[model samples]
Target chain A: MSVVSDRVTALVPSQWWQRSHELLSRVFEDDRRLLALCLTPALALYVLVAILPMVWAFNLSLYEVSTLNPVWEWTGPGRLLDIVASGTFQAAFGRSLVFGFGSVAFQIVVGVSLALLVNREFKGAVLARALALLPYMVPAVAIGMVGQFMLNAQYGIINLVLIRVGILNNPVAFLGLPETAMATVMVVGSWKFAVFVTLLTLARLQSIPENFYEGATMCGANAYQKFRDVTLPRIKNVILIAALLRTLWMFNKFDIIYIMTRGGPGETTTTIPLHAYEVAFNQYRLGEAAGIAALMFVFLALWSIVYFRVARPEEEVRVA
Target chain B: MTDIQVDTLRKEFSSDGGEIVAVDDVSFTVEDGEFVCIVGPSGCGKTTLLRCIAGLEHPTSGEITLGGEAVTDVPPQNRNLAFVFQDITLYPHMKVWENIAYPLKLDGVGADTRYERAQEVADTIQIGELLDKYPGELSGGQQQRVAIGRSIIRSPRAYLLDEPMSDLDAKLKKEMRVELQRIQQQVGGTMVYVTHDQEEAMTLSDRMIVMDDGEIQQFGSPQRVYHEPNNVFVSQFIGSPEINLLPATCRDGATVAVDDTDWRVDTGVDADSVPESVTLGFRPRHTTVERTADPDGIGGEVALVEAVGDENILYIDSEVGELRAVADIEQNPIEEGDSVAIGVERAYLFDAETGETVATSRRHGDRSEDQVEA
Candidate 1:
């Protein structure tokens, strides 16, 4: 290992390395130039990937274009207005709200609970924490498949167990029924992402000192009171930030829902992402699909700005 | 207000090496409204004992009682004790008033009433203007005052402070020590304070418990612990600048032969009655020094002259070891490398094997060791 490390070190030219170090130090000596040098790559990448694509989509939204026709016709903002006023678009937006809110709520509740549970000291606490994060590491395709198998009407363990325990007289076709399809897909879509919340909440929870609880105890606070006074305040900002990210991801979520229900038992789980996919691919009207995508981008950007302005989660870091 | 009685408390913590006894069969009492300071070196179980009394740490065996009620089984919250942690754990998110009135809020007090009470408590602790600011916005001393305000808000049965001012600078520590004493007097509550600083323990405590190795060496008033130390450890640990110890052995005619020197310590008692092997302890203040070339007296060269306030403490490098002797800075006019003769005006004779004080001199140049024994 020592010989290999020495050889690795020897691979770099000594004078060239010294020259580069000197050059870097000289460049970093100027604050404005250093700031520009540090930020340029990230800024360039963001513009290329995110900003350019969004601008292209917005420009595409102004024209009536189709893959089938190989022709573009200038239709202006009338096409965007028509897409927005359509019943299909309105229904998809409502479903997006339901799935987004439901998944975020479920994730926060389960994630914070899991974080609290695994934060304790026990015999196999390290193993338990690792196991709790295992779901998040699993691929989205595998999550959808496993979710489908578990919720199967015929041989699914869930229906069988519920029927065996006599809670249901019949095995319910969870995905086949429009009433349960959206709810089921929302849960499955949120399963892996909930661990993301757990990871953030746990990191924040661990940073809270043990003396805070002891101080609370000395202040005559009971178990519930301690949680409200000490634990909740410390973890509040992390939970809020997690919920914001989860809501954004859930709003634009497509893969797991597509894999499981494929826009539903008759459009039940068809969120904004699924609607845009169907409009772009199935209908082959690229302009309208781009219009829908552009609307989503604007909505999410506005929502993020509003959420940050209202919540002020940054105050926690300042106070801490 | 309640007196805390800890009876034969023993706390053992298991580590890879084995069981470590943190508090070893210790027992003491803090009378109602009295401030008792438990003083010790680090890891001496002083903090553990205070936590045990507050019911934060469960004892492996024995009991603690508050106002004649056993609280060993009770949780810390139910014990109604206010604890100021050594680290000064003020809630960072809460404003000063909210942190102060958290206990009242927990007790189902309304916001308006609790805020009013918090403001009053904050004012009493000299943090009235900081009520609207968060803990992170305050300095270390202000944060400590907020922590103290939180503890004193509800007037718990007793206050347990574990080196609350240890994190402050020397100037801030002195200021807070006086502020804490004033608050204790104003509240008139029983307090069990733990600190490693001997000066803090001496000045702030009604009675101080000097501990080492999970056991109390002596427990008494500061003056008593200073002048009448129960053992060598207490004598060395209690006094600032530390007490100097020299090895000596009993000789003929009520005298003890000092180490490798012709100097003799008159025990003021029968020489045969004194232990054959003994240790002599004398504080720097009790020790006297003179410029002399006499071979019969203890001789040393002053290595360092430390001028502290009105007195100059001379660190003498002698034949036996380094000895400390204090003198009036103006009168002594001492300098480094100056040869001086050292004398013990009042000294303590400790048993060499056990480190227990055998006898103590009663007065200046009046060595009546037998008088102390009687």
Candidate 2:
């Protein structure tokens, strides 16, 4: 199909698409109109599949609907407002703030340390770095299964080990109680996502020249001084972008928490995404679920905009 | 003021599991308030020697003394010295003021004092208006100035610069050479500069060390090193439009026969030390070319003529080999395929096998090493 489109574009020599071509050529050079023409099929497919479903869901949010029986009652945004005022959403929203920020903070701390460790040329450094990427590469379901196995109340490895170590009298119902459930899920979420931040920070670390460290040494900066003066300021932007991305991802993340605690013994671990999923699938409240998802989209968009405005690099962005 | 004395310094680096010696047994002294340049072709241990003195690289087996105190075990930070790297090492995240204030900051200076010193240095470098801009925002030349500013912000015992102006364009490099010399004189501190370009070395240094193959070829004032090169390597490495070499046999104490023509050679050497065949070395400026061949002159055919602003270098294929001779274009008019007679006005005679200097011209004034200072 691409070959056919290429041939067709080559056969047609017209100036009708000049304006849009000029606009695209400003972004990236050469073959602007034909490249845009080639992108049409993928754009159409996305509109049909991903985009159309989101638009349809947004449309459905203004009406009362049920999936169990084919009934659509005209509600005029009343159902959406009702969900917004509901106590379940309020509790879930509070829990999500704890989980999203909490997990993102954990990921940032762990990822930066890991990146710093692996950036040096130590023996077995490559193997150590590759091993650090395991959690991110493993399937979320497998991770959840491992978490369940280790945290089982009756006869789990964690309980047995804690008893032997004498740090805890027992395992203390790790994934089974309201107090520990969210924390447990956050641990699992952070472990899975931290490697991505490490990758980003590591790439940035590699680009920083060796001369900066040498310069600092010649200037009489000790090890700690060098890290504080040279290394930290250089990677500050990467760290900020990494933290922001992790926050965004952690907010929308559902599978790890859902399978690990299933939104917990109470709904203590029910973040906004998990709450929307439970509403749509468990209670068959399609309209309410769509409304919750739409709220999440708007909140994330606003947060991203505010975060960027506060933390964006002050220099004009140039292609590296 | 401090003087640096490096004694038989050696450095070996392992590459791909095999050890290679970078700096061989080398020794030299940089006198206080003097500017010394270590000049050589790339990979000739000039940079390595500078680094060892700066305490950036540890010598395999040797000693370096600053102000008569041995610093073999000192780390870079503990050593009272500053080194400017070849590539600009300005902190990209730092503004020019912060970059220049870095060495003072290491000494735990107060913020007010640090800024004061940084401003003074910036004004000295004529970069006062650029203090607030980040290093990344500055041009390459400006960044280099900031790097140099950082080095000089604190008064170290000596300054070691590793080709700091190598990355600039040619015009900027020429300008900075004179500026660096002026700065050196103003500060009156010992400075050890390393560069691969002989032109920069001769222009900027009070004394120059010509090095090759991890060893010092000659160390003296730029004029002495240029005029009385100790060996063939020094002779060839220190000059532009490279000096010509013709195989000759010593006939007596003052005359050498070159291609059946006798040229006068003066030296302090007794006739007993003179060898039979001496490889003759003479600068291009001393070779005179005439359009007609004579019995007393060496004849050659003109190969190529290169006009370089004020002078022309004629590459002539003569009986000995190809010889490069500097000519005034207006005075000595010749072109390709023109047969010319080459007259030798001045020359040095080195033993053919050992390449050690056997004779030199009386034009060099005196053969004593101290003549470099005179």
Candidate 3:
């Protein structure tokens, strides 16, 4: 036993390391124990960064708190419930639905179309595919700033080109009007992120074997029919997963909207996240903002559950 | 069903490296309701030729006609041809019945009618029970059956199969080969099949097109190709153990000196037309081997013996080259490490420089019984 221990010690440079290594080996012999050990670091990080904040916010929602003064007044669920039922929160929720779902749908359609276009075999196709994903790498702040400059009614190049092309007789203040502010914000906000869908959809598209199309052709399927049978079913799962991720991100997206419209044009573009921000900083109502954030979290969790149940996005795409 | 006529079809693919001539001025004709197979080594343009006929590939300079209707510029779907790929490409998301009914669905057939036709096809191909299962759940042979069922369901003008059975195991391949032949006869559709396996081509096709280097080496019945190979490549390619080839020189009208000059095979050609240097060819089944103390004939040692059912395939290491000879195991029990003498009862002489056939000992029309051994 002494010799065996000595050999084990010699395998490692230090006695403490050897003892720990032996302990790890013994613990890893059980599959459940090994899995728990592997997940400990990530679980700890998630609890600290995500779960703890959510729990703190939920606790804060039940009490009336102010950031200016560190005093908390005991309040029941009445205030939180009242804030949820208020017209401001209802309008913000409706706006978020429009923005989030609209952006996701637009991204999926354009991204899949772009992927299909670039998937063809031609000269410089590889370079074209690489260039197509460049937009996704641009910073959100840069897109917001550039969008503001381009949509400027007086001196923007877009207005100049539109006037020269006779599409628009006059320069329109795109983000300064109530009717166009939300639409403009949505399009600009989703510009850089649409290629996230493209990135994944393109990967799935490339993995599909060329023979599938050839087989479809032999089955008397026209071009649209080929896409419907061969391309769509293969990319359906990918598109669903991409839409789910994009919906979550767009719903919680704060930077681009805050930078472009600032929930502006008479509260036209105020989404749920922006509403929560305004409640905290503008109204100095920390407890109300925490309530809104907590509600958003619960809504997203429920939405994700339903999305998974209905869409059934698979982790691995099967090719036949 | 319509016959296909390919007139001087050629296909060239240009890559970054250079231009590749996949099918170089190939021409052939497939009669109505006939099963013709294009067989060759890999990259020999047999698959390309089949693709050209199916309209999956466009020839660089040629015209293709189906029943005398020119379809050179037609798309694959418009050409009304069914193709079975070598990989057995069945849509994974679709059930077996849906895959068989895909063409009818494309034609706007009602779901009930499509299912009825699919059921008929599935029963015909012996896949009736697998109609509800997806392609991912089926075995390789079952997937192949589903593919074939899909092809025959449409009753297209012709069917082109590109090495369809090449992925199956030996036993499964034989079974599918018979099933395909029966389906072809029942459907009576013009079929153009491509394969690199010579045995598959021989057993399945009514006429076989043997190709090499983007050109047709020979196109005839399997028996004619086996007995009267036009060149060295065809003879060596079509046989199982491969034909035995030895370098020789025709000394005169009657005599042809073999490998070591001491051994001579009698030539059955006229002296004036015979080439000087030639390649003597004989099939392993036709060549005879006996244990001999006298070394007047071509002498060799049996290096290996493969007992294949009733016959033994002997691998002989001779003075000139390694020779393959087949023998009846029960009548002549040959073993490894035995010294033997070989006799060529029938032989073909090919021009050595050009690898073209010059003469054969037996005339083409005279089919008679011959002695098996000397």
Candidate 4:
């Protein structure tokens, strides 16, 4: 009985050999390992420039760092709690939500309207479509400077036109005022992103089958009925995907807002990204900045999961 | 039910190359509850004519009256005509029942009634089990049945079927032909069917119109069209294996010379009335095969024999031209290369210049003879 058991045991691979074989096969068959080998240097550079700094900022957020001493001390979540309870951070957070949602709504409405206008064949449609995308292509810094010059209270073109037309007795201080600063940011953001939405909606519109419309017509559906029954349902999934993508992109937008409002005359246009930058570099409160960075990371991660769930159908079809 | 009358309809399309006349001066009338089958070759404007009747297309010059009211500007939905396209244009997204009930729903019929009617039609077409299945999930024949049911449920002024069974397999097509005829009879609705298959036209139509090059060649009962073609084209286009047209010179009243051989025909044309040069058209079944070595009889060497179950088609190479003769399978086992004589019992004499029948008087006499024989 012992000899037979020994013989059966001998047929099985030894533990060390099995482990080595598995390791080798895993290295051979694993796609992630292959990808990592190809992209390791670029990924490392990205981590160093972007991700590692974010991590360092998060670590510092848990510590009390003074710019004068250039030394840090562990403070845990106390600073984060204090910042959350403060009025300034709360106002900034509230304003960011308004800015994001307001801009996105405006962009979607205007963009869809523009897309519908150019969807049909018309005279000069090509030229009009090209011109519509020009605003999105302008450099963010240049747009900001130009906007500031145009809206300048003293002698800006907008003020000059208003004064000359007798619409205003005096030049309006547009950007300097609290009520108008956030509105200005939203308008600027919408101007930059509306073109993106238009392009996306146009592409989706073009992909709808012409036969569906013909079928609707044959079924005695009028124009509005056809759009409601056929066109809307057919493009619903694409619109959802476009909206989700735009949401993510708009949520993290920094350059347009920073260049335009610089966190506003009051903190009216200070989004989470602008707030983080101010805390870290401007105030030199690395620890608090790191905490804010980590919070922003969590918010973006939640958003990404929601976006993936919403946009999965489009991605799946593209993969197929 | 309303009768349809199309008066001198004409339609021309402006193509990139030039103008194309799709339908030229076509005129026909479908009496109430009549089944008219339009038979033509592909691209011969049969479908274009049906579309005009359905109000899917407007004639460039002409008027269509339904129930004595001009319907030139009426839309398809208002025309009360249901069309079954050749491609089985069932809505892929809709279930079989939904597709059938679509017309009822469009007319704002109640759900309970539409559902009951859809079920009845589904059962009629033997697609009751597939009522809940989307069109994409159904087979080609099932989809075609659904399309037919959709048209039938409307009970419109007329049902226009454009080669609806052309996409089905041979066995299915034969089955559907019988089913369509049965349904048309049961419904007692005006039906205008279009097909290139003469056999289908013969089986389904109360009256069949043979068209060619956007022109109506002949229109009459299928039996009349088959037995008495108005021109050589109708005679050739309407029969399987096609009718044999042999070049002949009318030598006298009772005879025509086919090549060097003098074949006796019962054309009944007087010597003066017979054209000098004419075409002798006879169907394959009309040409009888005899084991004769007579020099005066038309002679041919058998080229091939096609045994089609009940009959044998003998392809013979004659001096007049190649001819086919259908014979009983049990008799006349003439093999290839065998010399034989083919005799014409009755043949059509068509004027070579105009292709019009020169032997109409003979056809009239034959009809009376046939009646007396019956």
Candidate closest to the true structure, highest DockQ: 3
Write candidate 1's Cα lDDT for A1-320 as tens digits: 99998898799988988999999888989899899998999999999999999899999999988887877899998888898899999999999999999999999999999999999989899999999999998999999998899999999999999999999999999999988998889888887888999999999988888888898899988888889878898899899999999999989998999999999888888999999999899989899999999888888999999999999776665453
| Proportion of true contacts reproduced by candidate 3 | 0.79
Candidate 3 regions with alpha-carbon error over 4 angstroms: A1-34, A315-319, B267-271, B363-374
In the predicted model 4, the residue pairs found to clash are: A57-A290, A60-A287, A61-A287
- Chain B TM (all candidates): 0.95, 0.91, 0.95, 0.93
Give the Å shift of residue A181 in candidate 3: 0.2
Ranking by TM-score: 3, 1, 2, 4
Q: For residue B359, give model 4's deviation from the true position in Å.
A: 3.3
Instruction: Tell me the whole-model lDDT of each prediction, alpha carbons only.
Output: 0.88, 0.84, 0.89, 0.79
Weakest lDDT window of 10 consecutive positions for candidate 1 chain B: B365-374
CAPRI accuracy category, model 3: medium
Of 1 and 3, the candidate ranking higher by DockQ:
3
RMSD of each: 3.3, 5.1, 4.2, 10.0
For residue A267, give model 1's deviation from the true position in Å.
Answer: 1.3
A1-320, model 2: which lDDT tens digit per residue?
A: 99999988788775656767877777565576678888999999999998998888888888778986687877776776788799999899999999999999999899988999999988898898888877788898998889888888887788889889998985678898998888888997788788988888888888777877888999999999998987787678888888888888889998988888888788889899999999899999888888999888878989999999999834332211
Q: Given candidate 4, what's the lDDT at residue B123?
A: 90
Using Cα atoms with residue i matched to residue i, what is each candidate's TM-score against the true structure?
A: 0.94, 0.89, 0.95, 0.76
Q: Which ten residues in a row have the lowest lDDT in candidate 2 chain A?
A: A311-320
Write the residue-wise lDDT of candidate 4 on B1-374 in tens digits: 88989899998888899989989998878889999999999999999998888777778999999989899888766777778888665655567788788777776789889889999999988888888888778778888888889888877788888898988999999998888888888888998999999999998988888999999998888878887788888888998878888788887675777645656565555656778899888778876787555535666788999989888888988777788888777777667777777777668888899997777434445452121100
